[model samples]
Target: MAHAGTVSKHPEGFEDYVKRAKLSMPPEELQGELDYWRSRKVLQRMLDGGLITPDEFHKIDELNRKTFSPKLARLMA
Candidate 1:
């Protein structure tokens, strides 16, 4: 079973995308994107449970955005 609110838009995309990115994309950037999403999920949970404020979430999110410099995912944006 999948986790809540995190279903893939293109279910088959994961294998192909990750394979391609691993073969072609910079490892650190790809790793950063992966880590950001992982952190985002935990952060979201904290927000939902009122462990953190919206301001705190947005602030850290902004920092993640800058620190990650996400690129490949922008293709879907």
Candidate 2:
């Protein structure tokens, strides 16, 4: 079902999700989401290079951005 201000889940690009999620979040939350994505990208690169042990990588990745807020949590997921 459609609702006012709802955006589709099938985002076309990174900015698409940013634009849509921004509508439902405050400035602080939006920034946190951006930070989470940035950190995740770094972690992914480290994994690809085999710089981190798998257990260590999973431990770091398991840290909850949800402890921040819904918007950040969405980005973490």
Q: In order, how many clashes per candidate? A: 0, 0
Over 4 Å off in model 2, which ranges? 1-13, 19-23, 64-77
Q: Give candidate 2's TM-score.
A: 0.58
| Candidate 2: tens digits of C-alpha lDDT, residues 1-77 | 32334433332344665765557665555555555555567777898899998787777766734442436345435
Model 1 regions more than 4 Å off: 1-24, 72-77
Please give the distance, in angstroms, between residue 45's alpha carbon in candidate 1 and its true position after superposition: 0.8
What are the per-residue Cα lDDT tens digits for candidate 1 across 1-77?
A: 33433433333344465565555555555565565565566778999999999999889877877876755444333
Clashing pairs in 2: none
- The candidate that achieves the highest lDDT relative to the unseen native structure: 1
lDDT of 1 at 52: 99
Listed in order, each prediction's TM-score against the native is: 0.58, 0.58
